[model samples]
Target: MTVRIGIDGRVLTDRYHGIGRVTHELVRAMAGTPGVELVVFTGEQSASRRFDLNLMAMLPGVEVVPVALNAVDVRQLWRWRPLLRGAMVDVMVFPYHLGAAPLLGRPAVALVHDCILETDPRFAPSPQVGFAYRIMTALVARTATIATVSRASAREVERFYGRRVHPDHVIGNGVDRLRDDPAAARRLESEYGLEPGYVLHVGAQRPHKNVAVLVEAIAEVPDARLVLVGSADERFPDEVAPAIERYGVADRVTRLPFVPEELLGTLYARAALLAYPSLVEGFGLPVLEAMVSRTPVIASDVPVLREVGGSAALYVAPRCARAWAAAITRLLADDDLRDGLVAAGAAHASHFTWGAAAARLVSACHSLAGTYLAEAAR
Candidate 1:
């Protein structure tokens, strides 16, 4: 029997971020599965913005359905029940926690990327958002089969929501190897004033990202330059700007609010090393991406990063500027050490592939669908 899987593709309608990337890749990967059909529900596009899901929509066994309302709008919640019921799918997958509240008594899967908003309230920009996060997570805990991107995240979810995640449902993330482009390299250098071997950081300037300490560490290594490729949240205090000003290293840093995926691959391919000092994470995706690009990495000694980096990455305290500086300086000066890490990292990153992740997720969904069908017949 074919298992019809309904996916909440609302993330695709917004700006493409980590969660959206995961959904896109997984859907693409599952497109060729033997007995699964994908029905993706997307938000309506406005005159100002349009989402491109052409790749997935063109795939066999995949159907894209556009609802009348935008998923990000609160009005969509009131219409979710009827829309979901009307799909007549065997299983529904909410890629994130927020929209699964209406799926109670249905065979549903909710992917909880992290519990940062609940674990660290400061991560939430406002009290309203924080409260909403708490309520949605609690609702989903009762409504869906919860899954997470890493064992660390599964632990966090269980700790915060008291919901046990099946070991098989801890579906992790994957990365593809980045190709080296010489022409693009030259273009990036000219456009962004980028140096070939500068340190690279590729995430938002959130407080937990610990980018301020990275800035301070860059100050300690005068010859080293840094590229920050993510946007800053104005809702929080500008920690990175103050750190740059204090250290007088404004000239050594290049901050790009955003970059296309192709350029990001080139940046990863050309960087001397990747610095990820995030205090916590659901999964350290940048570490895996950097390793796949054959770049050595320096990440925090946090458990999730350690799980991702293994023996391939250099570990440093998340908050200590001095330690980060020492690690950076040491890694830069030692060519042998960098080469060794590059080799080890490539091998380590190869173990994570989108095919494997998609297989595990499909197996879980199939089981859920079969169980629900049997129960209904009884």
Candidate 2:
């Protein structure tokens, strides 16, 4: 018999960030599997967004539906409730860790990507919204089977919620090892006028990204330049300019406006080294992406990075400028260290695959549907 599966669609496509990528990967993999029927529910249509066509070609059983999830509007939630439950969705998977309609009382599985808000307080809103959402996460966790990306995260979830999570489902994130495209790498290097011997940093300039620490560290390395690729946002809105001026190595730091995904692989493949000194992260997908692209990475020794990068990355304290600088210089100067990191990264990255994650999720939905049968048998 075909198992009926419903997914929280907007949660997967709306952002297309870490959460969205995982959600899409899961859905795509499940669609290719046998004996499953998928109905994806979403608030909006992301039809135009670029997707890995390999995903579509692989999974033909999944269908996408557009419906307003009414994230904040209660009336919309109340109104959509009956219709969703009436549709007979055996199981609902919320990949974004957001809420569900009251109608989705069917055995639901919620992917708890991480507790970044708790790990880094600044990511939280003022005491009001922060505390409220944190409480909400706990409530939602209580209602669904908790799915965490790492053992570390699962432990944290259990600790925070003051209860053991359902150990039956703990699926780890997988890296899609990006093969090196030398021509593409060379083109990106030349297009950006980036020097061949530059250290690479990927991610947004968020407060907790701890970019300032790396900035100060880069100052110590006067010879090798630094190329930063990410959303050049205004988080440092006012402080960016003055900080660069004060640092004196502003002349050496080359910043890119924005490098789309196509060009990003090349950038990662050719970098002297990749540095990601964020204070906290949900899963730290970039660390794994860099590894897949054959780049040597030096990252903050945080839980997510450790879980994702393994021994493939050079770990440093987020705020330890001296340590970060020393680490970068070591990677640049020592060819052996760089090669070892690359080898380790490739091996570590090989341990992850989108298919593995999606398959387990498919089974979760099947289990959820079985729960209904057990209840009726009673």
User: Which pairs clash (backbone N, Cα, C closer than 3 Å) in model 1?
Assistant: none
Q: Which numbered prediction scores highest in TM-score against the true structure?
A: 1
Evaluate all candidate structures by whole-model CA lDDT and list the values in order.
0.86, 0.72
Q: What would the per-residue lDDT of candidate 2 be over residues 176-293, giving only the tens digit for each residue?
A: 7565566776777678776466788877666667777777888888687777765544433433445567898788877775675566677777777888988877678888888888
Q: What is the per-residue lDDT of model 1 for residues 15-41, given as tens digits with 9 covering 90 to 100?
A: 546787788878888996999999998
Q: State the TM-score for model 1.
A: 0.95
